[model samples]
Structure formats: C-alpha cells, structure tokens
Target chain A: MAKLSRRRFLTETSAAIATAPFISTSATRARAQESRKLGFAICGLGRLSESQIAPALARTRHCRLAGLVTGTPAKAEAYMAKYGVPAGSVYSYDTMHRMADDPGIDVVYVATPNALHAEHATRAAAAGKHVFCEKPLEVSVERCRQMIDACKDAGRLLGTAYRCQYDPHHLECIRLVREQVFGAPFIIEAGFGIDVGGPDQWRLKRDLAGGGALMDVGIYALQATRYLTGEEPVVVSALETKTDPAKFAEVDESMVWTTRFPGGVVAHCSTSYKAGGIQNMRVNAERGWFELDPAFFYNGNHGRRSDGQEIRFPEIDLFAAEMDDFAQCILEGRPSKVPGEEGLRDVRIMQAIYESARTGAAVPLA
Target chain B: MAKLSRRRFLTETSAAIATAPFISTSATRARAQESRKLGFAICGLGRLSESQIAPALARTRHCRLAGLVTGTPAKAEAYMAKYGVPAGSVYSYDTMHRMADDPGIDVVYVATPNALHAEHATRAAAAGKHVFCEKPLEVSVERCRQMIDACKDAGRLLGTAYRCQYDPHHLECIRLVREQVFGAPFIIEAGFGIDVGGPDQWRLKRDLAGGGALMDVGIYALQATRYLTGEEPVVVSALETKTDPAKFAEVDESMVWTTRFPGGVVAHCSTSYKAGGIQNMRVNAERGWFELDPAFFYNGNHGRRSDGQEIRFPEIDLFAAEMDDFAQCILEGRPSKVPGEEGLRDVRIMQAIYESARTGAAVPLA
Candidate 1:
C-alpha cells in the first residue's frame, strides 16, 4: 500500500471499532488500491440510492461514484448524466457480471429489495468487486451466509452498510458505554417507529420485505442495543401488535421485544408502523443514564446524560462516513467495522424474535 | 354512608379507579361516621412513619392520628405525646385486639415490616376495624390472600397504601391515558431505584422483603404501569443482576421486567439497589408520548408530553392523600380505590417475574 499518513487513514468515528482498519485483509493489489479513491457502483437505483447514498458519494473524501446498475434506463441515464460517469460504466443487473472486465469499479454497494440482496451481492463478488450491502443483510441467515461465503470464495471483502454505526452521535454513545464513562449499562430501551402509509410498498409485502415494522425499523433498535452493550443477547422474547389486520395482512404492523444479554444487560425494544415519532434510545448505567431522542434519524440527532453532560459530537454526513470508512478498509485491505458476520448475527436474532412473538415464549441463543 | 355531600366523600385521585369510591361497604356506622373524622392507629414506628406519615397525618383534613401501636414504650409515648392521643388509645401489637371496645380507633394502618403486614392487617380486621396496609400488601400471595380473607370475614373494608395511586401527577397521567387524550397508549417504561447501602437491612435479607429491588421499589414501576394503562399484564418476563454476589446472596440487587398487557400495551420496568436516583415513567401513546421525571417521588413530581405540554399537577403530600382517601372510603362505606385485591394482583405478578428471571422464560398470567 502507498504510505498514506495514518492521519489521512484514521478518522474520528466509533471508538468501539477504532482498531478495525488495521486488520490485514492482505489484498495483493494493495499497492494499486492506495493510489486512488475506491470506486463504488451502487447496484440498485432505488430511493435510498437516488437520495442519500448518491448525494453522499458526491462529497465523500475517499470514495467515488463510479458506475450504476439498474433495471430501468431512465434512472441509469439520470444517475450517469448527474455523476459524469462514462456510458461503458453502466450495466443492467442481468449483465452486471460483465463488469469483471472493467477496472473502474472496485466495489458494489447492494441496495436492492430485501429478498434480492443475496443475488446482487454474490454477483458483485463473482465480478471481482468487494461487496457492501445494506442492512438486514438479507431476509434470512441462509441468504446472508450465501453472500458471506460468495465474497470469501471470491477473495473480496464483504461489508454491511450500518449507517448508524458510523453516525457520530451513536459512535459517541458507544464510546461512553464501552468505556464505562457512567459505569456499566444494565438496561437498554430503544426503538424506532414510523407511520409509513404506502399500502402497496414492498415493505408491507412479506415476500419482498420478509416482515413488517420488525424488519424495516425494529432492526435499528436491535442493532442499537447490540452495539451499545457490545454483547449479543442470550435470551429474547417478543410480542406483536397489529391494529389493522387488513392493511398488514401480509406483515406485522408493530412488535416489541425483550432481550437479556449474557452479562445481565436487559433491553426492551419496539417498532411500529402505526405509531410514528418514536426514535429514541435510553441506556441505564450504574452511575447514571444517557439517552438520545430522534436518535435514529438521518440528521438532527442529539443526546444528554443524567449528570448534566451533553452527549454531543461534530456534525457528520452518515452516508459519507460509512462509504469513506469502507474505502479505507478497501485501501488497507481490511474488513469493515460492520462486516457480514455482524449483519448475520442480527438477522438470526431477529428471526428468533419473530419466533418468540409467534410462540409467546422466550428463545435462548446458543 | 355519610351525608357529607359528595364534596367530602369524593377526591381527585386515580381517574382509572374513580368509580370505586361509590361502591358500598355497608358499615352500618354511617350516622356515627358522618359526625367526625376517621380515627387511625398507625401500627408501626419506623422512619417512614416518623418522618412522612406522622407529619402528613397532622395535615390531613378527613383523618386523625388517634392511636399508636408499637411494641416499644418509648416510641408509643413519643407518638402519643406528639399527636395528643390519650394513653388508652395506644395498644401493643400483641394486645391490639383490646382496642375493639374503644371507639377512637376506627381503622388500623399497618406499616410494619413487609412480612408482618399480613399479621397486623389480619389482626386489625379481627378487631372489627377497617385495615389499610402499606405497599407489597405482604411478602407472598398466600399471606396477601390471608389478609384479604380476614378483612372479608370481618366485614371490614381493606385498602392497600399505593401512595402514588393518590399522587396528583400519577392521577393526571391516568386521566390523560385513560381518556385517550393522546390517542391510546401502547407502551409504558417505568422504574424506581435508590442505592440503599445497608447490607444488613431487611430489604437485603430476602425473608422480610421477599425480594430485593423488585419488591421494594420495582413495585412502584409495576403499579405505575398498571394505573397508567388500567390493565393487568397478560405475560411477563424478567432478568436480574447482582453486582456483588455476597452482598446480595439472598436478594436481587437489580431487576428488569418486560410485561405485555391486554389491549396490546407493553411495559418495561426496572429497579435497583446498587444504582440510585432512577425514577421516571414514559408512556408511548398512539398520537403522542408523555413522560414523568422523578415520577414516583414523594414530592416534586413533574411530567411532559411530546407536544410540549407540561405534565404538571398540584403539589401533594403523598401520605396525606392516601390516608385521606382511605378515610373517605371508610366514611362513604365503600372500598378505597387501591383495594387489597389490587395489591394481591401486583404480588402475584411479581411472583411471575421472579419465576421468569429464574427460568429464562416468559410467564403467562392466568
């Protein structure tokens, strides 16, 4: 690798994963990789790709928007025209494997529908590109494993795009809890809710999204508890509520879960499509407590502690932070702070939560 | 019943149980009851009795501290001298039945150790006087039932001293949620904790307090959820932590519970003896959320809503409110809002929580 200053390579993000970048992925092309910014081809022109990720890539310091993969021509044309990419850099999803011949794209960020993640990620790996997939990782553990194994077999890194894991506020919260700044946290209450009203959206179709609020928003709460506690839950129980049976016939409208970590940390998490404005996370520690309101928002997040301390961090573009970090990982030939395994852990736990909710019992993790 | 014009017979307590006061107790002493304040013999002389309850009694408009029942002569003499009660009005616990012939003591408020509550309450009932017991009711369900049966057998109205049930803040909170002022409530997060350091105290002894923070302070959180949601839990789960095993060998040092109520409401509650200064309650309603800081405090309780409405209510002397409400119940010939059955419900649910924590499963309520 080119001798980039540790200053340029290191950035203020999660103290919890500060040492992750030093891990040796041992990519033989490290020398070539270090000379230029990592190129990311966003593999789906969905709303997130059109709005947050693409706009964020425009401002990232270490990552460049290199190519587009989409089923629709207008979206591809618009993104290509907007980003100044060559027409040869664009490919339809069916022909994305041809990108193996192109050297412009070093990574593919998969932001497809839930059930389609495994296919896109595998294709990206098979095309000799690192894979960065959005959350839930996929709909099931088996699909996530397929993605993980495909990337490993292809000798390319696989990253899970956990944006909050890179958000400054959540990073600071992780620092506080991991360092025991207010003593050990014993209880975590976290959740996300949005009154998503699209009746025909994929998120409401069980086949497309896999679940309802628990899949779309509840995963945020589950991830918050895991990252903050730095421990996977040992036992989990859940209860679900569905106010409109007709509207949510193919999915769940709301869900609540109770989880117990090995160290005796307990968490209560909830997610809902019926009740909005519920993005918050509270950690009750030994000496005091700290909480974030509007916690999981894309912006304007803030927090405070019980001892009159403000939990503030510098402003950050979440998408840029995540992508830049992934770029650094690629350059260093290391795995990301949020890897495929982390996403797989959450997916398996969420499956247990659903089983518990259905059976009205607590499910213990092995 | 009293001809005391519903003005004196009615009160602003729990809106959830507002209709309880009109139920008839049929004491057959209404003509005698209407002429004077109800006389109460405080059956314990502990710190709570000396500091809060005694001073609160001095200010109660509908009740009088007419007697004292203590094994120690010094405590008996001190209370009698302070309250101006005659020597004959005082009785030792062993001989408390002797007061059955005396007209000065119409009710006995049992504030003994948790394990002794049933004994004292049953004794009071056998003396043909009404019984008002402190929170927890008893150390176990069987004991609580014994007290309830004793009162029923004696044809005496039995009240449980759930002080917050009469706290103005909690009552207003109940009114808001019960009235659906913020649509319908779906989630409740409540708890109380004080770092009581006495390792030799009855609370840590297990036998006296039955459980540690779960019984001592977690009950406050349970009662808050019950009153605020106006529903009993359908299933409950718990996790317990003991930071110092030796210090808490016989009792839990900290405990957390997740409960699902009928009507799709779920609650997360916690209590700790090792972590202090934790008192708050948040209710997630359909349209908005309301929360209280210093929620279960004896004073200075305040709350606010997500819409920026301050959750303020008139300041209240908690002891006076509960005792006066009991007095009104006796005078009106009806059960108090927090009846013995209410306390029994909590004790049994607490048992389920402990069982869940032990077995790592969710316990369903019958």
Candidate 2:
C-alpha cells in the first residue's frame, strides 16, 4: 500500500467523511437517504482533515461533504467555500451535535488527533450520528469500549480507519493464509516506522497521539496480524528504544514486541519514528509463505506465494471501498468489516505493546 | 533455489572434501592436473547434515563427493557404497583429522551439534584444512572469535553458511536500502520462526545446539539486517519467551530483539521454534521501502519498491553462489563473503539479546 501523502491523505479522509451517513431515529427514510447519498460533517479541519479528508469526501460518489466543525470560524468558512458546502453546514465543536437537526449531514467523522477521538465520537454517538474515526480508537482501551458501548446504546454504527484491512493486497494475503496454502502458519511479522519530523508535530505529544508511530502506523500491522491469522493474541512481550530523551520525552522512538496466541503462532511487530519510513508484514507456513510490501503504505503493493507465483487482485480504490462498505452497512443495517470490536481489540493490543515497552518485559495479556 | 535433501547435502559435502588441495600447500602439478574439483569430508551425517547439507552438495558443481565421517561404521560403509565412494574415505570423529593425510580431501564440513563445532573445527583448522561450519559459530562469542583467529593463524579459510546473504532477492533488497533508495533507513524489521517438533530434539539440549532457533534461523535475519544496511548495531534491547519451563529446558523457545545503530537505525528481529513460521525482513527509509519474503527459505522470495514494482535480478543459484564464492575465496586467496568476524558480531548481538531478554531492559553492546 502506498503511504498517503499528507495532501492526499487529508483529501481522501475528507472525501470519506463527507460521504458517510448519520444515524436517524426513523429507519425507513434514513436508509433511503443513506443509500442515495450519505453526507458527512468533519470535526477537525486541521492539516489531516483539510488536506486529505475533505478532498476524499469531495471525490467520493456515495457521499458528499456536508458540513465542517472547527473551533476556528475562519477555517470553517474558508473550508465551506473551498468545497462548495452550504452556509447552513458550518458548526463549531461546541455546537456539533446541533448537526442532528440538519438533514444535510448524516455522519460525523472525527479526524482529530488520538485524544479527541473518544469525546468527539461519543458525543456524535449521543446525537444519533454514525461514527468513523482514525486509529488508536482512543488513548485507552476503556475509552474505546465506551465509544463502542455508546454507539450501541444510541443504535449508531461505529467504525475505525483500519485501511489495510480493506487493502486488496493485504486481503489477498489474508485469503491465502486462511486457505492454509502455507500449511498452518506459525508466525506473523509486521512493522511500520517513519521519520516524523520534530516534537512540534501532534504525534510527538503523548496527550495528542497516544503513543507514537505504533499508534499511527504500527497499529495497522497489529490489526493485520489479527486479520491475517484469524486469532486473538493472548500474551505479549515488548522492548522499547529511544535515542534522545528530549525528542522522545513522552512517546517512544521505536519498539519491538511479540504477541502469542493460544495456538503456537506468535506475531512479532516493530515500530519506529526514529527510523525514516518502514512498513511490512510477512506470514510463513509449513508448506509456503505470503507477504505484502510496501505493506503499510497507501501506494501500490508487491505480493507473492511461497510457490513463487504472484498473487493478483483487481485493483480498487481502498479508501473508496471502505467508504462504500460503511455506506452499504448503513443502507443494509449490517455490521462493518472493521466494526467496534475490531477497533477495541486493536486498541487493547496497542496498549499492551506500550505496557510491555514500558516495563521492558514479556507482558502476558491474559 | 532448492532445499537440499540430506543425500545431496552429504554427497556434495563429501565431494567438496575429497577432490581438493591441501590448506597449507597446493597439490603438485601432476596432482592438480588430475582435477581441480572441491571435495568435502562431513564429520556428522545426522539428519540436518543428511537432509539439507548432503542434498545441497549433490546439486553443487564446484565440489564432488569425497568421504564420510561417522561413529557408526556400518552406516558409514553403507553411505559410501550408496554414493559410490571408495572404501578408504570413511572415518570416525576421532580419526577425522587423519583424513588430512589423504590427498583427496580439501575441506572438513562440520554439521555436528553446536557444542562440538569449536573442538571439531579447531582440530580441522589445526590439521591444515578449510572449515565450513553451521551457525552459532560456537557456544560463545569468545569461542567464535577464537575460531576466527585460529583459522587465520593456520592459513585456512573459515566460512559460516549464512545462505540468505547469497539469495538474489535478499541481496537486491540490501542493495536498494544501502544505496539509499529508501533514503537512509531508520527502522529495520526482520525475524525467523517455526514450529519445532518434540521437545526432546537435540535443539532442546543447550550443550548440543548451543541455543534454540535464534542461533539457528534467527541469526539469518540478524546477518540480514547487518548486510542489507551495512551497519553495525551499537546497542541492543530484547525479550525472550517460552511456553513451558520443562519443555524449554535448555534454550528459549522464542525471542524478540532490537539492535540500535549509531544513526538511529534500529533493527528489530524475533525468533522462535515454538511459534508459527513467519520469516521476513523489511527496511523502512525516508524515500521508500524495501522488503523480502520467505526471507530464509531457499525458494520463496519477493522483492519490490514501495510502489510495488518487482525489483528484477538475474536468476542464479544461491547455494551454488555460496559454494562458488567459498571456492573462489579459497582459489584466489580472497576472504569469505560471510567471514568469521561477521559470524562473531552476530553471536555478540545474540548474547546481548539473551542478556536483554533475561534482564527485561535494553542491554548495550560494546
């Protein structure tokens, strides 16, 4: 998968958010509107929201960019004008729930940094809005479960932006491994790391990004491990390394961890911001192997079987698929490919990696 | 690249031993005129030696079958007859050095259990014979270094069979990363793991296999990180895991390790014989990513740029290249591509992994 460039990422995320649907008390009309065209209101219009999410929404066919929610009035007005959003579509974070009163907006896509996800998503769920948020789910597992529970209580859907699960190459890998072409896979190795500039970035802030690249990109690998193996990790061990205490004052620069399942399979993963850019995953079995690379990025991918044949999949827009799937779920009243529990499980594992990294030992997740 | 069957491995090993020149002195013009073929004398015809090594040798062209070294006289006699070896070529471990007295042999390939490599190779080196040994080099880094120095002093070459380094796909990945195609990589993820059979195997005996799969297959990933990046890891942190104490009596069943180089490049590697098999290596750099799949296995491989174009290379026999390189090093008086010091460095790092795994914190390597 190609790494979504900052500009493209924002554009894609925006597009996805704009087309997503909101929850309605009346199922019949809501489902009709949802199937026709889902409208999304984005909660944050910062770099990620403006550059990727908005553009993604604008480019989406199943959804439309309905509204903007920003504390900054100027940004809200400017973003609405740039995307041709109507004047009634603008709302501040304090008044975001009022969007429920507007028929234009169907879903609330929270694209803020890690810490804001829980509050924004929970409030969106309360207002009877469908929720789609970026990764880490929440800074804590408890908070993530809370989001899930709130969404359940409100009868609104909850989904995470685990794009890799929708990625064609990754899906193919999962398919092959599931088929046992490799013969009882015993190990899964996954990792993602990048040189994410200075401490000025929101990711460097523990309060904002939760944990580092592991939260940002590494979680994809962890999620991939689970999806590929179809097993839950029962135990975990980890090691964390940081070069400069000042640079990595709160979050880690890099980490290596292992997750053990009830079966003999172990998933090993590594993540680093200190390293330039890295993303990859490998699955090895008795008879053969399956792998994906540039595993974690948003671009094209390379994959093959242990028998030396390329695994080909008809290319589809991953972001589009994710958006369409969510829309379809809402239209059909079904569950999502990456539902709340999937998000909860990944967050749980991410937290375990942090715990293991902190204690510098094997942490049993039991 | 074919996985060598025991018969082929031993036949080639014996061939490499039998048809060769002396370590200290070349054969006379008349003797050299007979044939410039490589011959091997294998000391232990155990399963691994028989299955992988012998089959690999039979497939090799640079060497021809020469002799067998076994404690079982009947077995040795049977193998010689089966492979069409002459009667005088068979010898037991105690009489292996005396094979140097024969003009037909040139190298002594040590496929014995781990703890015996030092004594066996030391004797072979002292006997003025080139030595080909399996990994772990020896039980200790000090012993590994001693093996290196002894071979140097005796004017005999020492080569460790790090087969992955000879793989075309792996070499291409290393080349791309080192050339900065990925642009000064920051994080490296690599690992080897497989489900081991009954716990009573020699690998469970610390004195025999030296360590578990970390010393066996995991070392491939370690050497891979070093060769691919062309950097020495400066500091280390790691964690080890085992399922049952009784079953994991001698060595650990699983490990997760990290090596931090001076420039903030961290190589994270995990190894396990008790886990599912998942072997792979990935280098994440600023510009892009490069990865290898089925990393250590002979056949399965896929290498590519982050954009997913298959990085192409001329197909060549990896084992043949390894054997041929050793032959050239011996013929042209060049150093081995995978030399003793490289073996020693990995062992040093392995020791640090064990330390960190034990102490539950980062351990620095000097």
Quick one: best DockQ, which candidate?
Answer: 1
Count backbone overlaps in model 2.
59
Model 2 chain A scores worst on lDDT over the 10 consecutive residues at A1-10
Question: Per-residue lDDT of B42-126 in model 2, one digit per residue for the tens?
Answer: 7788876666666666666665556777778776665675555567878888887786675556677777887888888887887
Interface DockQ of each model:
0.39, 0.19
- Residue range with the least summed lDDT across 10 consecutive positions in model 1 chain A: A10-19
- Interface RMSDs of the predictions, in order, are 1.9, 4.7
Q: Against the true structure, what is model 2's DockQ?
A: 0.19
Per-residue alpha-carbon lDDT of model 1 for A251-363, expressed as tens digits? 88878888888776888888888777679898888788888887988888899988998877777899999999888887676668899999999999999999998998889
Q: DockQ of candidate 1? A: 0.39
lDDT of 2 by residue, A132-168 (tens): 8888788888889889998998888998877778788
TM-score of each: 0.89, 0.71
